[model samples]
Target: MSVVVAVKPSARKRNAKVGRLVAAEGTRHAFGSRAAAERWAESLSTGDGHVWIAAAHPADDDDVDCYLVSRATNAKLEAAYDKRRRRLRGGEGGKQQSLGGAE
Candidate 1:
């Protein structure tokens, strides 16, 4: 499942004190601090569900992109593998478009 923690200020509340938590599935909640929101997201990220905390909406991004941004280390690992794979595939200087391209 794809989970994202949207930390944005409540527009309905005048001069909101903290950020609000909005899940990708439309689940809404409020958090007193960014740390609290991140913590909540981390809690939700367990077992099969890899939670992603985003301050802004991932409007143009696909699921894989969103999932990767959630974990920096995982993204780095993927990049490294992609470089090696591209080198084996005879990509330009071992740097192709990316791992999952249309071609």
Candidate 2:
């Protein structure tokens, strides 16, 4: 079976309720191998968002088991972005300093 990769955005509600991600319409791409699908998914995950991958027919979107793929660098990038945003909003932009003396 061919592997399918697509950027499926979260369908979670804004009120902090649980929700599943909805697949993008007409955005799925089929790859011949898992490695190739992973590569493409990783490429699409350069930012804070995640990409979804599943092994099944490209036409079948709902029944296959899906997994998320995110780049390792996304955590660091998201941290920096949050820090910058906080700084812009008049919050501490760096790590908190401990007030206690070293033992």
User: How many clashes (backbone N, Cα, C below 3 Å) per candidate?
Assistant: 0, 0
The best candidate in terms of TM-score: 2
Misplaced by over 4 Å in model 1 are 1-26, 57-103
Off by over 4 Å in 2: 11-25, 47-103
Q: Which 10-residue window of candidate 2 scores lowest in summed lDDT?
A: 11-20
Best by lDDT: 2
lDDT of 2 at 18: 13
- Cα error, residue 9 of model 2, in Å, equals 1.7
TM-score of 1: 0.32
Candidate 1 lDDT at 41 equals 56
Scanning candidate 1 in windows of ten residues, the lowest lDDT window is 11-20
lDDT tens digits by residue: candidate 2, 5-101: 5533331221111122233234345668778767755555454245545454557656433443323244578898998788778788444545683
Clashing pairs in 1: none
CA lDDT scores, all candidates in order = 0.44, 0.48
